[model samples]
Target: MAVGSVALAGTVSGGEFANPHLCQKGQQLLLYFRTIYGKQILAGYNVYPHTPDDYQQTGRHAAIWGRDIQWLGDVDEVIAHVQRHGYILTLHWHWFFGGDSAWTRERKTPVVLDQLLKPGTPEHDTLMRELSKTADVLEKLQQAGIVVLWRPLHEIDGGWFWWTDLQHPENTAELWRVMFRYFTEERKLNNLIWVYSAGVGDLKKKPPEWRRRFYPGDQYVDIAGIDIYGVDLQQDETPYWDYFRAMEEICPGKTLALCECDAIPNPDKMVAGKTPCWLYALPWWGCPHPRRSVDWARFTMGHPQVITLDELPLFDDASYAPELGILRPADDGGAWFPNSVPVIEGFVAGRGSPVDLLQFLVDDKVVAEIRHPPRDFSWTWPGDLHGTFELTARAYDAAGKQNLSNRIHIAVGVRNAARSRSVRASSGTNPEAAVDGSYYSGWHAAKDAEDAWIEVDLGSPVEISQVNLIWGWKIHPAKFAVEISRSAPDDSERSWETVSLLEDLPWQPWKATHRVRFAPRIARAVRVHAYQRAAHQTWAGYDLAEIEIPIPAR
Candidate 1:
């Protein structure tokens, strides 16, 4: 399925839809994001009713220019929302020249199309001014240090959007050049990076002249991109790869991006890391409207790569895990980014100090919470802990008192260790802060025995989708695997349950990265072990550079 020939999904047998927007993915770009999009991207509304359905079918994720984009009342609502809750606002500009087709089918009312398509009129100038007004917003946001991946009039070669039928490819290209040159080159807006896109199916089919016409010129473009929403790709074996091959041939050396993509999942399986410079990836908004599912919360947090506008910063943070109740909190001065709350479990160690803890997200929202020390028996939070200087206990079942644990409410501030502690993922850089004084433990080593491996405290049982194993001699036959047991960190004799393994790579100064995904299984702690041998003796040592923990579906 090399993409020279792509079968249309909704077409009849022997009939092919050959317009070039069909998606055959090449490399899965890891994008990280959140579920919220608001005022920051208000300009996207210029495209009109920029509905989620439009996003799926047309590849327009809201960069519009119109007076109606913002609510008349209080614009601060969106501004405060992002500041307090860590919601992301994506900036996108889409083409609107075509009369609309299948994806837009009967949805973009004719009235809307008329307004968008009517170029060179007073009304259009006013529209342009309105869009330009969003510049004020972008400038202000830049001062605030918010990053925007500004994509304007994307995928020109497809001939479906506004660039259609424009005289002289240079004229359309000039339009693009003027936009950024005026905004950045002249205006000195350095924070904005351009994403140049095209969805024209096969590069071979394009005559040199036509392909040349599609480009807005390389000077203004920063990132090469494409948009693909497949209807029947899941039915095929290699749906996305072939689609990417088409773009790869067209763009040649430039990195191809999923400008506005959600055609498939498990992009990590397709594109592993930054080696080939797959660079930045941000998927379309989480189903833009009520059509968005709650599961999007999981999708936003679980995938190591994919991110919504809301969770964009998490990719740079590298530690936020939404599953364990930790979330990417908006930057709180010097506080560790991406907080977590206590993730409750059905069981806890009785007659023991609580090893569990709480962490927050980037938004500083309560992601999870753990009742640090068990109440010496099975107990639940019967009421809010607003202690009146003493502890209270109540029994659930007096008839079976032996089986029931009494409810206990005690003042917690003096014992809340989290007040002075930091929530973070385990790493070599954090050896002192590595263990939370928790009971769980396992070992992970780096290049050798002295490489210093620390057992990650899982805090609680969780299913992990993928684990990153890095740093080992590629030529070495050393095989690495993780072992899990109910064993405490101090004890090495506890029974171990081996789960995942890592294959050694050609050890370079920068280790070749590998992503290992498996069915989600709950484990409290994992030990990474690498098997190696020497002449006349056999030895096992572990080496790692970076590790990415992806959570699978529950």
Candidate 2:
């Protein structure tokens, strides 16, 4: 759903900028010169594997994704490239999916960690050792003053990463505890900010107890992130926006992030102002199509609600991309610029077939439409070009359920940079569960074509804690114990190992969920992989409500 057009903000591409400033939010993007794309390794123009046209390309890590990269250039070569770009050098465990879902060691050596995620094994040890090595790399980056915004173990709720084997919550916590100790305690490296992210999935519909099983708390993460990609209005984008609103409310005290994001497609659509549907119920806009084009730089430069590299890059002043005309004052939408009225029309949401998301800027009185006739509709400029407005669109299906839209934003006279907002906003609400301290219940629901969840955090290190589930009020609540696993903080850098099983206790009103706390072996986090383990049931299904752990609160 995320997509946006790139503006080679007129920086002398070859040479680095002489300034040393972290690109602050709301500032224009100063031209950035990087040879990598996302978190994967990329062979720069001076390195091997660089195509003849590498110089013409926008990013270096163009095609690579995942851990265990086979780089043609060594870390020194990477440093050299960074010197040339002279902005902030960026490296990431970019793609943590596919091919056994683990780190690949030797360049392109296809070593995965999927098998290692399972309970109890030597492979798990190997994973931990490898993580220590990765920490070494992070340490180096830290020394460079290159504030690395490393997001290693992201999207935990999705059963994709090594720490989330649904059957091993304790193991997950153990792994996090080990990672935290290795990085924060042993390594003594603190120049980096850690981000724990989840896909922009709804957590509201889920029961409170089920959401606590995978709660990696504020103690572990520096920034609580949610990966939000823009969506084409042609499809429902409620889920993405809902996450934004939820975070605004529940995580008011925590720093928020669109840790990973994509601009909704069609640079033209943004020309007008805001997306309409967002004014209403948030919906998932994952229609089948590639509306993802806008890069992170463009987005951070524009939106200030979320924290991004521009907010704090190693090199000062690296945050803003000034050349994109982002800092310039908007000239009343249509009347001000040469292309002011240019209509921006295309798929704002992913629809089965392409749908029109007609948009045009307004400066004075000029008008432009991005879509052609027949498909395009008409509208007029109402108030001040840069003034915010709640726009409504008209379209309907046979049922008149209304293929509708509504959004709020301002036009001309706004800041010159795309980031300079004509309006202001808050991060929004979290899940109902967070209201009480039930972690996931409030803001971390998994509502899609999948089974729901429950999770937890041991608070501080503790031994095999009792994972008590309140199955029912009756006979020995079927035996559904909470499982656990521990992983390296950078789960992608290593793997996971199963820890133990804490079984059921007396049923509580909060569904069949609760846990026992002891002066257990000290560890950091724990997760309960919900399961329907008791074979003999009339319904033959698993159901859990809430999860609790008795921790000596810090």
Candidate 3:
């Protein structure tokens, strides 16, 4: 059983978490973000259809969702369906002031702010009622062992919501503290991960530093985030970069996220702009203008650095087993060139018997063994390495039960065998481009071909273990097979043996590498056969940047 699988009623001790295991899981999730910050980004969205559309287009689900309070009643059902399936959850309330809609700019007033903060006032009573109601909903989740990323009074500096005290904006900070104290001390809702969101005002007028004026201090917040929209989606994203830096300055050491966005930031552009990667992104749903297209969704969701729903680990498992996670060499399929030694770091999580030992394995062979593992342990590759390797960590508890961490694949000291090799295609414009070793060039199949394929002749049978595919910018074929042929290089009707049948390929954006590893085989030729194009593509054929078969060191 998972953490939320069982529901418990009543209060937990000392305002502590109702489910300690679930809290550990939440910490693990935060560690995951911390490890990836400045390195990678997580793909997220808001509400239901966005989730489904993400899955439909990318063959993967968005990692997280910012759920609106408007649909508070269905939250439990939503949690059972999505959260149980590894989707991270956050709640955003568009509070109504005295029953008035949050959208009315006139609802934000100095008089209302004063009344809401002052006791014995009608507005203060209303504030208590609303906060208590929200607390009750959160308590339900706590009872069910679910940890929430709770975001309240978002866009406080935007002057569009009642929570925004435009006349005396400092009152907004006090308001956040009040809710923090109420929910944490009074209601004992310790399952929440508090998020303080700043509004991205007109950069030209207000500038990024304007956000610092409303911060409620670091102690009261867990994550520092911002909501940006209508910003230019260019390679040089100076505005967003400045905003993220400002957030870092204001809430130093806090994880940053795009809590609400009209456009998802591209990981490649973020890296190019020298901007720190966002922990996650939550874009609004179904907006007609600035709407995320299928291709755009595929690009963001499929990027190797972006974490999809399917990539989330099982944090709530209830088995009597220790949980292990890898913390270093973060990107699973990242390639480390020849002679680079990778430092492996990991931890054993949850409540159970202490881990007796930790064994770090490379390709199923134990390379380093720790007799008594600490809360976190480290191991270094003993020598310069070569070949494609699968790395994992196994933890053995005192009683001898063991658990394994998720596996990560990396290549070291390997050269692309398919480069400058003979190539052929059934129907494609530039089939040779796939082996040309150029990121910008690729082979594109003819639209009329029902079963499209491109083959690379290795000149003669050589020992090979893996293939790395760098896909074209806008086109991807989710279903394909990697086959090897031992027949003579000149043979037209070569007998092809399928080594790997991939039905759903991970969303790897343009020039991003997706590796397929298999047992070592002797083959003169290898080919990728495409059965179908991605469902949402208007392009009639498949396309990819390069197909590389890495030759392992002998």
Candidate 4:
């Protein structure tokens, strides 16, 4: 196959299969994920809950529920219930053989791929028996007219599974092909939608090259997926977006899915065009990870963009599908100073389709056409242009199918006066570090102090509209007041005017950036007065990684 020659699933309708050439389906079923479902993401969960209605705490059932086939006694009952309720069904198998679990052999004594494929060998026999058993269950589902999103040999390159061998991608691909043929041709199980899932490799590595190594080809896959767990969605979603783009290039016309996840990403962010559109997400079952809670689940399930079980449509709806979202400048928009070049970024979804041209538009005019791989989804504006303008993007595939991004309005000539400015704090310890433009260093207040304050001198009176406080690692002030003064900071008799009184800051135990925007004001000095520290904070005083003051115009 050519690098990006395959036609994408952009034109396929929701709930329908893709053309057989794209995969085994007649029409792209998950094309809707990047189109209609782009605005309505399918939320799912793994395994059943202890209590029948435990997940109802989110006020609704997920659109799909996945399970390890080994845990169920009667797969038919579960299949019937899922199908009867109009919910999607997904299943996986953790093969146990020779007293070793699926994850027990890869590192120590891995299953040799070649031996497993050689029919007469013991390894081959073991695989055939397991495949037969799994096929029998799938055959039952097929007989019952139930469609399954089946994930077998998941995370093939993760090195945790018995079949994994990063150096021999061809072997992994062959293993998948063998299973694909056994289940589809021999067993004649047509109800399964094959999902090829990759593992989230080293947390620090965000490139997609490693994932592409394990791909078994488009003919053997209906959906390309990745398993995400333990990563805090509250922090940054860049890694997920990066992989989302990676998978699209790896399998140009396959539906992209989150086979397994820990935290359910915020749908609001998706609606705001901050992340890629996934076909569906199945969060691991049971106790919520610390990053996720019932409240968060409720928020995700209840959001209009997040489609729960009841929200799924009865029939296929294709109309038009395209998922191009502007992830930079934010959906809320941004303001930059004149002569400041801003980076524009976006996400393209829908069967991990390849983008031929990602054109950055300003007020409907093409500013730049990003032709290279959107590794970071980043494109720097060529010139330092200033003024309020509407921003949007258009991504065209090889077939010229267009995916339009969400539009945002941004203004230039907004300067950050606090950058490299004279800053001081009550602690009198390296106060300048807070405005040093480095998140690595911060200023901490006096130990066990009842109060703390950090002030910045803007050099000259500038109209400041926003103040961004980058909280230090796990430390933030619960209550703080932003005060401005027209007089010099050293003046003992200078009067300070309270501009904004912020309180009850949420406990987001991470280095998070919080923004406070107020009516534009001209002030020579701005200071933050901290009262109570955030809950569970072990530090004695308020700490800040960096502070930014954006003046709408000088």
- lDDT top scorer: 3
User: How do the residues 1-554 of candidate 1 rate in per-residue lDDT, one tens digit apiece?
Assistant: 01111112221221111111111110001111111111111112222223222222121222221222133233354445334323234456542323243223342632232343357865456545644665666666556444445666666666555443334555556566656655664445545545677653554575435655757655566456666554232233343555455555555544455554443334334334211213333444333333323244234333434333222232221221111111211111111212222122222221111224332121122333334433222223323322111112221111221111111112221122122222222333433232332111112333344223334545556555445433322212245566655655556686667676655434432123344556766655655554542221123333243333434212
Q: What is the lDDT of candidate 3?
A: 0.69
Please, what is the whole-model Cα lDDT of each candidate in the order they appear? 0.37, 0.34, 0.69, 0.67
Q: Rank the candidates by TM-score, best first.
A: 3, 4, 1, 2
Highest-TM-score candidate: 3
TM-score for candidate 3, residues paired by index: 0.53
Off by over 4 Å in 3: 1-22, 48-52, 106-111, 208-210, 286-290, 318-554
Q: All predictions: root-mean-square deviation over Cα?
A: 23.8, 26.5, 11.9, 15.6
Candidate 1 vs 4: which has more TM-score: 4
- Could you estimate the TM-score for every candidate? 0.39, 0.37, 0.53, 0.52
lDDT of 3 by residue, 186-205 (tens): 88886788888888787557
The per-candidate count of clashes, in order, stands at 59, 126, 2, 11
Q: Over the stretch 388-493, how does candidate 2's per-residue lDDT look in tens digits?
A: 2223233322222223232112322322121111111112123223223221122232322122233343333344443333222111233333434354233565
Q: What's model 4's TM-score?
A: 0.52
Worst 10 residues of 2 by lDDT: 279-288
Better of 3 and 4 by lDDT: 3
CA error at residue 355 for candidate 2, angstroms = 45
